[model samples]
Target: MQNDNMKCGLIEKTESQFVDSIEKEAYVWCEKNWKHDDYEHQHNRAQLTFVEEGYQYFHIDRKIYLVPQHHVIWIPSEKAHKITSEAQTVNLMVFLFKSVFEDEFYQNVQVFAVPPVLKEMLLYASKWNQSLDENEEQDLFFKAILKSLPNFCKESSSLEIPVPTDTRLIPVCNDINVNFKYNLDIDSLAEKAQMSVRSLQRIFKNETGITLQKYLQLTRILKSIELIDTRQYTLSEVAYKVGYQSLSAFTSSYFAIMQVKPKINKN
Candidate 1:
């Protein structure tokens, strides 16, 4: 049912319902309404979420990835996940099924960091969604994108925390964002939420699939990397800004999580 405002984000239309046949093992459609939703769920088919605009938080496992404009997050089949829309932004997703992905389904479900080539291909495919079976050229185009899906896989280890859809969690999440520098602890956070520490941990695990401490460490690490890459902060300053008291500890954590030494990616 369309809401009074008439906004929707999760589109669930089938081939017969939306478009004509595209090719064997593949179909195409659009999600006209991407709205604010709460909760985490996974599907039986590996799917592609192509965000044409706006921002959101994509939760898989227990790590949180901040999805900004033109970013797409792919959720593997049966991997529990939740998504929260960035305030007042359009959330777009292009879902691909397992058969279309072919043999690459053996790899882990990925939230690909979409590059230009992938973006262009998706845009082109979206345009032809209504033009399925137009010609042999259309068949080739579909095949090309199907092959490239594996190439879009990105290496992301940390997952986002899944907060329950509740008024209490919202303030708590906002507080975490605001006071990121302070020593983050479960007890303090629970105090803010007016809930017991155990309760907070329980829901956080249910939503994000990881411990709160682990999620916080990942969040700090991501923040540190962004600052370092900007060429504005020295590694030392970046360390302190992200709540790491010692550079060595920070470096160790960074290397352990990302499996790469900290250095500017100039290219």
Candidate 2:
């Protein structure tokens, strides 16, 4: 087992494991099974874990990423990490060597949402990986698969968690609006929507690829900005109204979620 800190020896599976094989020595196919277990592995090759079913929780440094169906997590070559999944989750991985994607991929590891065409193509490849024999079927599936590879090579921020579908989060969001300055904790917000904090956490992750904390911070800051846009309150007053006790706290949160800082003079 590889510790979270140590970069493990490389794990390789034959290209026959993937439905689509690149004619070049750019990638390899592998099946990863981490059901209901906790393990952390790091590598020098950028890896894509495609979730076939169930859910996966990945922690990079201390940030948690939820991987559900229709999504995949990209782990960069050097980051430290840990992943935990419950029973019955199946993940398909296509581990691409650095020599393959070349300089196109980003240095960071993150999740990308699979769109329609790519999803079908991957499903075809996965089924193909399992059904076919390992031989040089070079011209057929190889070329077709490789062309799609480069397009997907670039990182996309569009991949994200779906919004919380729970009947509660919306109302709870409303409650937050009505009582923006309450300084309420997540528990209180969850209770208003009749959900436990853990349940809230999972649903929120499923619906929005980001975490609850990030979303909450975004929400509070957005509210503060909207009110401030009217030019009615000073930055300090707006910050307090949005549940931020300290103006510095509000500014930091605002900048973290939205790349832009809040304007003290919106007029």
Candidate 3:
């Protein structure tokens, strides 16, 4: 509801919802930290949301995705989802009209690497609001941006952290998401959910496509990535911050999952 134009663009309302004032093809909302009102909502247009400074978490269809900086989240039209962040974040969000791109490419929710060229174009395009009337020069730029999408948007699966859909397991899932640092044992989690350990194991794997142990480890690693990027804590400190008991154990786990060692650079 609070919209600051910032010489980037203006916010416009359509059907009681606040959306970026779009041009013929797309509209961009660049913000330091955008506070959204609705918990879950759908749009008639697809979106490409890129983080400019930090990371964001998105929940869609009972699954969660960890979207980091310089990555693009491609959300198709009519997909109901919600976004959140552990701290204040900055993002460059672009909404594209459904007609602007091919259906096959934009039909599903995906996270991709944002190529440099596309990043520049989006930042430049964010400066102007769309109009029904476009000059030849503006039209050329719009077309160029559209053509560049395929090159910049390469689907990535590594960052997706699955969340369970079952109502019974929802509480456990939420716990791991928010409290990844807690000592979460499978037996204790199952007991807390009022289900037997074996039953919980089966249900968790069936619904989330991951074993409980893997999910917890994945969640911790995702949190570690955020913490390491902050550069405020040493690698050892970050490991403990995210619930690992030993630095060696945390390093091994981090390398196994991330294919890289946890390194912090203050510079």
Give lDDT tens digits, candidate 3, residues 43-123.
666777877767788888877787776678888877888877764455555545545566466677888767778778767
TM-score of each: 0.52, 0.44, 0.77
**Candidates' RMSD to native:** 7.7, 15.7, 4.0
Count clashes in each candidate, considering only residues at least 3 apart in sequence or on different chains: 12, 6, 1
Instruction: Put down candidate 2 lDDT per residue, 1-267, tens digits, no spaces.
Output: 333322212322321121223334334354555433245545555566677654566767545566654567767665656666542435555635443334344456666556677676666655444232444553344445445554564344432223455667777656655766765578887887688988877876776566766666655764664566456788889988888889888888867654446675422
Q: What is the lDDT of residue 263 in candidate 3?
A: 77
Candidate No. with top TM-score: 3
Write down the lDDT that model 3 would get.
0.71
- Which run of 10 residues does model 3 get worst, by summed lDDT? 1-10
Which one wins by lDDT: 1 or 2?
A: 1
Which runs in model 2 stand beyond 4 Å of their true positions? 1-33, 127-183, 186-267
- Name the TM-score of candidate 1: 0.52
Compared with the true structure, what per-residue lDDT tens digits does model 1 show for residues 102-153?
4754345555457789888887777655333446665677668767766775
TM-score of 3: 0.77
Residue runs of model 3 more than 4 Å from their true location after superposition: 1-23, 124-138, 148-151, 182-184, 229-231, 245-267
Off by over 4 Å in 1: 1-24, 31-33, 36-45, 59-65, 78-82, 91-93, 98-107, 130-135, 162-181, 185-214, 217-267
Tell me which residue pairs clash in candidate 2: 161-207, 161-208, 161-209, 162-207, 162-208, 163-207
